[model samples]
Target: MPNLRCCSSSSLSLPAESYIYQLCAAGPASLAAISSDNSLRRFDRSSLALLPDGLVKETHAAGVSSLCAAGDGLLATCGKDGTVKLWDARRAGAVAVFQADKGMPLLSLACNASSHSIVAGTELVKPDAFVLFWDTRSPGKTCRQYVESHNDDVTEIQFHPSRPSVLLSGSTDGLVNIYDTTVPEEEDALVQVVKHSSIHHAGFMQDKAVYALSHDEMFSIHPVTSADEDDSHADEVKAVEFGDVRPVLKAEYVVQVLVDAAGSYVASGRTSDRSLSLTPLVHTPEFHFEQSNSWMLPGAHGEEVVRSVLFDSESRTVYTCGEDGHVRLWKEEPASSAELSSIRPTKQRKEKGYKPY
Candidate 1:
């Protein structure tokens, strides 16, 4: 057990058994633990007991910044060392490592729904934020890099649940861009860049400036992979957004929803109390994370905020990580449709002369 530094009412000191900053739930009873020492360990979710993975020391240079597990024994990790590495978790060895260009730190990573491809977002100190796409079939090889859209640091990247080629990314510049991998040269064809009014035109509102706003909104959608369109040559592919939209205090909390395998429910984490929020998989432009009502979890690293969140589709569990070095899991009782209906405030009821008959 490692000592964790926490503040006490009387004083600040390191305590025994400090929590790690990273966590991934491989199954209902299992989780992968990434310690500050750059070692990877698997633990039992119920008991938090370490499993016998034997300290995988592959990421020696940089602490693991991000991790994703592909359905079939595949695990991918990104490091501050400006590198992305793929590993065979079942074999416990490094499969391949890919390096990024100079001056960009690998900020976020995601594996396609098929788990055949991987994509990463990088921080841009010089020109603009960019994303790198990798064909994981060939590990340790070069990946296709794209930098055509973002003007700021790329903060979040998520692959569409059903469309392996479709990807969505959010950035500090307050822009969301969707990409299609099927396009030979994606820079040419794709959805128009979506910009939020509150974020892109934030300067116009002086009174609500302190309210955090949607400048750091993270996005998740239930993507439609393929459907016959009116044009015989083209297939209809789109993403449906649901749930509440939130104004996150930190830029990383912009988008956190995870679509269920059945395409029914979308699960997301709220920073306020670290509560798990669930929403339907319908087109809900009104579903925003209302800052005033949401719960925020305690900061993991001193005052450092949450950097990433993941979900287990099978168990319907949410795991979150932050700078505080604590990985917390949130589980809520499934809500019935009747319960959800009651929670929604009625517009007619809000009217001045509405009377309950």
Candidate 2:
């Protein structure tokens, strides 16, 4: 790993109590962010500065729960308001809105440009949770729904990197379900199911393996394949369980996985000394933990929990945002270790009632 130092940061413009939980690469030039303040903001990817007139003060009625890039400079955001909005990065207002039936609160969202569909997972409303899908071309029409798959709140949903018809959903019920979207029936749509913990973040890895990270830091990777694509696959694939990474990395929490062409990297953090590291999982002949190439961020978001991390392979830079309402940029230091110049965070507010939810 190259020696990294904090390079740039956006001004603390968010509500001081807000937590910046989501980040999306809006396009080549900009990145979009959503916080607990129920707003959407954009930053210049190069400078890490908030763009002028790039603030959407009210992107959602309730807390903006998630944000995802919808290809071609468009951004999508979901909320506790049970709605999702699409925006063009150049504009400050949302261009279109999609709502869940009976306004079910949505916690996770995914977009498939290849399939021309938007998928959002809802919090468990009563006895059941749902994954709702909307055709981008028909905003006013009702969405196709997938019910009876997960028993608890659906926390994450993502489209297959190569096959858009294959979608994955993870939930608080300790299950990750892969669905074939072309099938309309709920039972028929369900393809593969992997038992896991209460999933905090789960999705496809570069090696076509499925990774499930639980809220309590339990992490595991499982091989996945659709029946039609590979019917000879095992009925129940075993996982390479890396349980409770907090102890393994000496971290207070595991943020999220950032997967790029290089490999799949897990972003883990320790708040005690305010450190973060992106350690790649080597998946060639088999999965292996590689600590030698672990990229370390010495003062990640100070004592705040890092909610989102982004690595740009082309520029070789890393971006992070946290509960402290700060978005920071990091890059390799050019000078010797003695000449390192990572900036210190500003004095934080009293933690009387702060929570890293």
Candidate 3:
């Protein structure tokens, strides 16, 4: 268990109706956030202070839905406007825009630096939903499209942090699909799919597992590789259920799930009286999650939803964004022996089965 406490907080004086939907860390010292007002804002990571003159007014025609920190000081964002735009962290204007067909709203986005590719997931239209890809060097035109990959709107897409050719997508249709982007054909590109009840978000846990959050507030962790190399178990992937099934963190609504950089803990942004809850990946021999911990900022988002959370491993600091249009920073407080003991598992966690290390 780790000590957690809010050290500071800040926000712009936007209309009460404005809400922050997404957050991405540009680097150790800077963060980029997107809001319901169709604006993109930059903040100083340490102070949680809005940078002077660091606002991009109305970057999108509609509310921005997704954002990612693309390498090389670039941030990628997409919106209901059916456009994907990239912004240089050092400037105020967009550097590139990738347009989609009419009525196709971009719902999710991901960028792979090694492959120099940017992918956007679009809303479900009459014909079908699509996963659009573009080469960062040639952004005006789409390089390829994966049609019929998802039957419903794609809610999340993420590239494998270390594997350039691998990608993951989660949809409202309750399916988590993995794609081998090197494959040219849409049908052949899909390598695997993990079914859930209704996925709210999905992402790779390092490179070994895919973790998904359901709309029902339940979560599951599945192996990234299929059980059988023969392809017989293609549709029968196994998963370890948590949350509702095991009752790890008592959260009302989980806005986002994040894996710490060191992979020691999994944090969830809980809304409706916003707070950040953490669960230790290490478990006791009884196969139960350790006693979890949570932290709430002093005047935090006041009943608003926490949309996203970012953990800085080097500094051991936490950054969070919420529907209240504020970005808050939290740091670990020195823990006393009694406080430390209370957070540890009643029994020592076995290093044997499913150790995150």
Q: Which candidate wins on lDDT? A: 2
Candidate 1 per-residue C-alpha lDDT over 134-240 given as tens digits, one digit per residue, 9 for 90 to 100: 77677644467777777776756766544566666756676666666676675754553555422211110011001112333424332222222322212221332
Error of 1 at 347 (Å): 19
* Candidate 3: regions farther than 4 A off: 1-3, 226-238, 243-247, 268-274, 283-288, 292-300, 334-357
Question: Which pairs clash in model 2?
Answer: none
TM accuracy, model 3 = 0.85
RMSD of each: 11.5, 5.6, 6.9
- lDDT, candidate 3, 1-357, per-residue tens: 444677777775455767777778886678888887778888888776777767888888876888898899889988888888999866668889988867489888999888889998888885678888999889786889888878888888898777778889888788899998888997888988988866778898665567887767667777676323444422333467775632456555555656544553445443444455655554332223454444334334566666677767666667777766677777656662323224333333111111110
Regions of candidate 1 where Cα sits further than 4 Å from its true position: 1-22, 27-29, 33-37, 57-60, 113-115, 197-255, 261-324, 328-357
> What lDDT would each prediction earn against the true structure?
0.48, 0.80, 0.71
For all candidates, what are the clash counts?
23, 0, 0
Name the best candidate (by TM-score).
2
Q: Per-residue lDDT tens digits of candidate 2, residues 1-357?
A: 555889888754887678788788978888888887778888898887778887888888877888999877788998988998899866657888898989899999999877789999999999889999998888843478888898799999999887788899999899999988888798988988989888888998743578998988889988886757664433344468888887777777888887766567888888778899887776544655667667789989888778899888777778899888889989887774421112111110324222224
Q: Which stretches of candidate 2 lie over 4 Å from their true place?
A: 231-238, 336-356
